[model samples]
Target: MNLNIMGPLAVNELISMDTNLLLAFFIGVGSGFVLESCGFSSSRKLVGVFYGYDTVVLKVFFTGAITAMLGLLFFSLFGWIDLNLVYVNELFLWSTLIGGVVMGAGFITGGFCPGTSFCGAAIGKKDAMVFIIGLFIGVAIFMAGILCGRDYTRPHS
Candidate 1:
């Protein structure tokens, strides 16, 4: 397989925009399939993590993180990827902490993370469907706030 050594394949124009999108679509589908197969589409599996009954979700995520780290390392070693070209988002302390708390509450109550919610919805799970709807509503509200020039992270002073 050919690889781009300069930078991100799509970002550096090594691949066409259409190809990039197509690749992303396939990867998303594959990931969803894997999640469902691992029973991640079921909210019970994730909720078990919090209750100390099941730890598969936690294990899977930890494994994923380690796998990604090693993959990036190997890719860089082979000149297939350029670490310098990678973009990392800026860290916001308060927002990040608040978001984590909110997301944790959602996961405990709703039983699905953003990605697993979609995976569950794909299989016609009603609760997952509702979660997705609520997710979209939340996104719309957040976007509206942003469009209206409301900085949620700041005080009203």
Candidate 2:
């Protein structure tokens, strides 16, 4: 049996590990199936967090974030996970601050974080799908208008 495992990458770098694209696709399918089965792919259920109806959404998310963060820190401390090889998010100071504010606003208004929204969409939530679509289009158009090159394209009499 031949397989490309961790092709061209160190054994510890799972992100760089290689495998069949088909396998990856199936893995995603399995994951989506699990999420759907767990009832995460519902928008109204997610939005219930804001109306004092459900805390499951917020609790699950916070727990997951804390779990992952703690796992990474613990692993790094024990020399299991390589801190140097980990990818750290780039900080464009202004963009990062503004992005965080926008994200927080989304959480407050939509009563769902990005992950929840994605999960909701996966289960065929029409509102989630529309929200996700509009989010992408809005960001795209906003960026286009804000790009510095727009100034040069302005009509000068």
Candidate 3:
């Protein structure tokens, strides 16, 4: 059987710890190699988020959105998953737009989006590592705030 990562990566486990682990590992390595080879891994390429020198990020993001929209439409048509059953977070218009702008600004300033930050860390980019560290800290803080509902949590652990 051709074990695919789509399902397993989503659910947690892969085919087996033996071949599946190696397969997934090498697959990730190979994808990173290709991204770097294609200049997608470079900070320069990411500056498209800023001065218009690059548009790959926008293109990729839009394309992925288009793909997902289409997939959701089709999947709903086929009744694979229920669309109405999915819940959207209560709309915070300001936070949504502000977050998008800040995220895009961060992309321009850091040349590393959230998704690419991990790739940068994987390939030994110091800035990427720092960015990821900051990201984790932010996430931890947010989660602790949500779970504990007070400053007493500290989120040290």
Candidate 4:
């Protein structure tokens, strides 16, 4: 018997778009529930990893990463997935460095990562709501700056 399971069901044409979207919605909800249950919705709990007061976040992050890597490796070995078909972002060193610095600054000053901010805000945390608002404002400002920069650099035609 021939069997093929080389990748995502969506890619394999085994799942309809509506079903995929519904599954994604449910998965997102489940993930949020898990995150809230694991105390990730709390800003203090998240920051505790940085302060050495709690390392659960770090441990959980690493465990998840390692598990994903191992699963991918095993799946490839078993011919269940095609590694070459995976989409990986092209590296831009300077942009990556700048983005990392900005993200780190936000994490330190805001006391909540983006994911936690959403989770916290979902649970009605005022600070998280403010952080999310600030994030949107920042994005707006950044877009404005980009638009201005583009116009300034455009050739007079």
lDDT of 2 by residue, 29-109 (tens): 876675666556776676677788877667766886899799888877665656676677765666567767887787666
Q: Which ten contiguous residues of candidate 4 have the minimum total lDDT?
A: 148-157
By descending lDDT, how would the candidates be arranged? 1, 4, 3, 2
Better model by lDDT, 3 or 4? Answer: 4
How do all the candidates rank in terms of TM-score, highest first?
1, 4, 2, 3
Query: In terms of lDDT, which candidate is stronger, 1 or 4?
Result: 1
Using TM-score as the yardstick, the better of models 1 and 3 is 1
lDDT of 2 at 55: 71
Q: Taking the tens digit of each residue's C-alpha lDDT, what string does model 1 give over 1-157?
A: 6633565788878989999999999998888888998988899987998889999998899998899899988988988778888887667777778878998888888999889999889998899999999999988988899899987765422
Best by TM-score: 1
| Candidate 1 positional error at 32, Å | 0.9
Candidates 2 and 3 compared by lDDT, better number: 3
* Predicted model with the maximum lDDT: 1
lDDT of 2: 0.66
TM-score of structure candidate 3? 0.60
- The Cα local distance difference test for each model comes to 0.86, 0.66, 0.68, 0.83
TM-score of each: 0.89, 0.64, 0.60, 0.86
lDDT of 3 by residue, 1-157 (tens): 5343343232345345677667878988876775565556667777765677778767776786899789988867765556665554665666567667877777767777666777777778888888888788867976887788664333232
In candidate 2, how many Å is residue 129 off?
1.6
Candidate 1's TM-score reads: 0.89
Candidate 3 residues lying further than 4 Å off, grouped into runs, are: 1-40, 87-89, 140-157
